[model samples]
Target: MVDVTYNSDLHFEHTLWTSELTFWGGELKSLENRLNELISHWTDKEVLTKLEHYLDEFNLQSNIVRDIQKSIQQHEINILDHTPNGSESMDIPRVKEHLKLRHKMEAQREIYGNLKKDFFLFSSENL
Candidate 1:
């Protein structure tokens, strides 16, 4: 019974932290759009490779980011100790377009923003 009580409390904390990571209208979607533009415009076969890298990175990132989101959902967020962007940077070239998203931490006043706390980047060395 005691364990269950603790677990419930823990879950609430996790939910709160994840809520903050939620994407705002322009932040994450814009980045996705930019990546799509690169995908659409690039004629070279190498574009596939770049796209793969983007996908792979996104795949890996989502797991960790999801955990963070889960924590927020559980109300475990430490807003004061929280790190912005969650990491150093994203390497994807097209990412430059959405750099502005970093500025707005919250999507709405009452709700936490879900703008993907980290940037999604692709390496230039491949191309």
Candidate 2:
């Protein structure tokens, strides 16, 4: 079904462990089948609520991934813009914009990295 719980605090290690357990020892296919069955039986009101919740969670996750991806893409663009691939070198204005965007992207990546590292380490220890 939909993972509608709003938590950016999802532990990676916990997820990995749960996934492994599910496939190995837990109800893997049965869970999917059960969900399908529920969907099949769901009323219009219930289905709409489920969809709404899932959509909200999906959008939240989407925004996060999009922002990170955009930052990385911008970093690459900045690097390319700064480098002289053609005959002419980058001028002062272009160089300034490139450096600014590159720095912002680097900072954002660092934040994402640190959060992931902390989440993994914490979950590993707790698990």
lDDT, each prediction: 0.41, 0.44
> Which one is best on lDDT?
2
lDDT of 2 by residue, 1-127 (tens): 7333111122232244334333422332343344455556657775546534444443443355455445445644554555555523445554455446446545744654564455346435532
After superposition of all CA atoms, the RMSD between model 2 and the true structure is 16.1
- RMSD of candidates 1 onward, in order: 16.1, 16.1
TM-score (C-alpha, index-matched) for candidate 2: 0.36
